[model samples]
Target: MEWRWNAVFLVSFGVVWAAMTTAKPVSSLDPADAETRMLAALEDQYAHDPGNAVLARSLAETYLDLGRPGLAIAALRAGDPANLENPMVAHRLAQAYEASGRVLDAYATADLALARCARALGTADAPSGTPVPRFACDARQHMALSTHQEALGHMLEWGIADPARDARTEVAYDLALRRASIASAR
Candidate 1:
């Protein structure tokens, strides 16, 4: 038992040390180069350990920087529910949908993901243990909302924000209004 405890302590200390010094950082808008490479390494680890749902989710997130929605979707697909997919996979799916020019599908998926986050918010893990807050825990809600909102913005800005003043004016206006509404509510 003594030897086992020492081994565990040593391993835990090593992990903590690495995490403190070498672990990658995350941000909502921009990530540093070191962070990017760390994400890539994490993705590779997920690929090696296919059964780790948390790893799968992380791998999907990391690939977002690579502008590879398809691969991100692939990784998130492998993630399990519970703590993994309920939210992120949905958002990434929306990204993939949008990239594929499936605007309606993209909106639908993003909505569902945000809804899931909303549903999970402050509920299961509330301080007072009250019912779920009907939205995400605080950070989670904002993150979900941000991703969906950003996706909508991207959809609007995808084609230079240039509109066809001729026949497609109505279509352009509709899209612009939708994006504007989403952004304003942000």
Candidate 2:
């Protein structure tokens, strides 16, 4: 009995000591470090697939989330300029521009996104037999209002007195509000 007790105590102490030496405390792990590592991984992926809109968008979005809007803009621009079929890519680029204090760029990008959104939602005229699929339209519709609002905000903040500013701003805000209502109903 005495020998068994001594063996168990030794085993327990050894286990405790191993755990203490091997395990890091949860609080000691830096979240920023993890985020930086993830950003690096994303950059590697983007480098390998520069033409991939989804990968580029993800990388740019991650950079934007990390408060590195310049990096985000660079990622978005790395893709083909004419291949912004994914409206959200343009939307994210617009957001990065806004965050980086490039209001004019933001307005232009958001306007481009809005046009893509319109086409995706079937609001733009197309061949009579070809309508946008319901699911596809629904997927893109959610972002329409936000994109319009972004455009309007950027235009307002551009601080230039264009002759068409009043009409354009009104139209943008009206569309944004109308889309918001439509979105809420869904």
Relative to the true structure, candidate 1 reaches a TM of 0.45
Clashing pairs in 2: none
Candidate 2 structure, TM-score to reference:
0.59
lDDT by residue (161-185, candidate 1, tens digit) is 2222233435544655576567568
- Per-residue CA lDDT of model 2 for 118-165, tens digit only, reads 666666332335344222334445366354545456456646334143
Question: In candidate 2, what residue range of length 10 has the lowest lDDT sum?
Answer: 126-135
Instruction: Report how far residue 82 has shifted in candidate 2, in Å.
Output: 4.7
Model 2 stretches astray by more than 4 angstroms: 1-32, 124-142, 145-179, 182-186
lDDT of 2 at 176: 62
On TM-score, the leading prediction is: 2
Number of the top lDDT candidate: 2
- Give the TM-score of each candidate: 0.45, 0.59
Q: For candidate 1, which ten residues in a row score worst on lDDT? A: 160-169
